[model samples]
Target: MDIANSALRLAERRGAAGKAPPLESSKAQVELANARIEARTADAALEAARRELGLLWGNAQPDFESVDGKLDALPQRGSLDELSAALGDAPLMQGGRLAVALGRALLEVEKSTRYPDITLSAGVARDNEAGRNMAQLGVSIPLPLPTKRKTPIANWRRA
Candidate 1:
């Protein structure tokens, strides 16, 4: 807009001095009008962007006037080593690591299921009518049946 305004002023001055044709001033006015329209359009876009950013922050109506930043400035880049170190703490990387740990834990649990569980029992009973006390003890071990255990592991892998 500034550029267009300057151009229009220059054109008007040249026209008044008889150095530039009348068409030059008309062209400059048109350019200025176009610049104004573009400026308005740019403002609308900026507002929309601000609103969108506000929505991301859970705000329906943003109270702030304008965002602060240097549009033309480039962000500083990190060194390879620094970036690599940071990658370990990245959300996606951490998720992957956690998933691997979970898979291993699940595998260990599944492997354990292959073994039978042993049960130990002991009890004492007193009978007033018989005037006697009896003690009992027993041990039992469950027999694991042969079944397809790979299906669950395969499902986990697929997931």
Candidate 2:
């Protein structure tokens, strides 16, 4: 918008000096009107962005009249290599990696659970009338049941 306005102003000055063609001056004016409309649209978008940001921060009203910053003064961006290196340690990327690791660990645990169960028992029975004691020992192992498994989890259990 600033660039458009500047061009229009330059055109007006040149027109006043009788150095600009009438058609060029008219085109610049039209361009300036379009730029104004674009600027309004950009402002509305910025306001919406601000409102969304406010909502993210738990604010119902975003009252700032204007954002304060110098776009040109921002530091030059890093190279893709630098950005990619940073991503390896970024919180969002790390969180995703952590989630994947957690899923894998959970899958391992679920697989382990599907392994056959082993049970061992020992007991002694006393029969005072018979004047004797009997000892018993037992072991039970359960085989995997395919009928009870379901969907994707079933595949892991089989594995």
Candidate 3:
């Protein structure tokens, strides 16, 4: 926009001095108009995007004026192999990998339920009447019901 404005001003000055053709000033004016329209369009888009971003954070209206950054800089190009390797670390790919890991862990837990857990207890009790301490030991092993184990494993396998 600035460039276009400068060009228009220079063209006008040259025309006034009779050093430039009238056509040059007309072209510069058109260019300036185009630049103004483009700047307005870009501003509208930026504002809309800002409002959208604000909505994500539960804000009805955005408060900020402008964002800071350079849009002209291009990202460095990479080889196909490097890009392929980087793809594995991308968010979507990471999510997929995590989902697979979660499923495997869930399946392992379900498989573990096929075997019953063992519980062991040992305690010493003071018998006041006998004036002696007595030790007791106990072990418990829960029976795994086939019905309890089969359903979840089947469900996971189906998934």
Best by TM-score: 1
Model 2, position 105: C-alpha lDDT score: 90
How do all models score by TM-score? 0.52, 0.49, 0.47
The reply for model 1, stretches above 4 Å from the true place, is 1-63, 68-73, 126-131, 149-159
Model 1 residue 80 CA deviation in Å: 1.2
User: Model 1, range 26-57, lDDT digits (tens) per residue?
Assistant: 99999999999999999999889889999999
Show model 3 residue runs off by greater than 4 Å: 1-46, 51-78, 126-132, 148-150
* Consecutive 10-residue window with the lowest summed lDDT within model 2: 148-157
Worst lDDT 10-window in candidate 3:
144-153
Candidate 3 structure quality by residue, lDDT tens digits, 1-159: 999999999999999999999999999999999999999999999999999988988998989886777799888989999999999999999999999999899889988877888999999999999999999999999986555344677888787
Native-structure RMSD, model 1: 10.5
Clashing pairs in 1: none
Q: Give candidates' CA RMSD values in order.
A: 10.5, 12.1, 12.8
Error of 1 at 1 (Å): 22
Tens-digit per-residue lDDT, 70-97, candidate 2: 8879798999999999989999999999
Regions of model 2 farther than 4 Å from truth: 1-67, 72-74, 148-159
What is the number of residue pairs that collide in model 3?
Answer: 0
**Which candidate do you rate higher for lDDT, 1 or 2?**
1
Residue 111, model 3, lDDT: 85
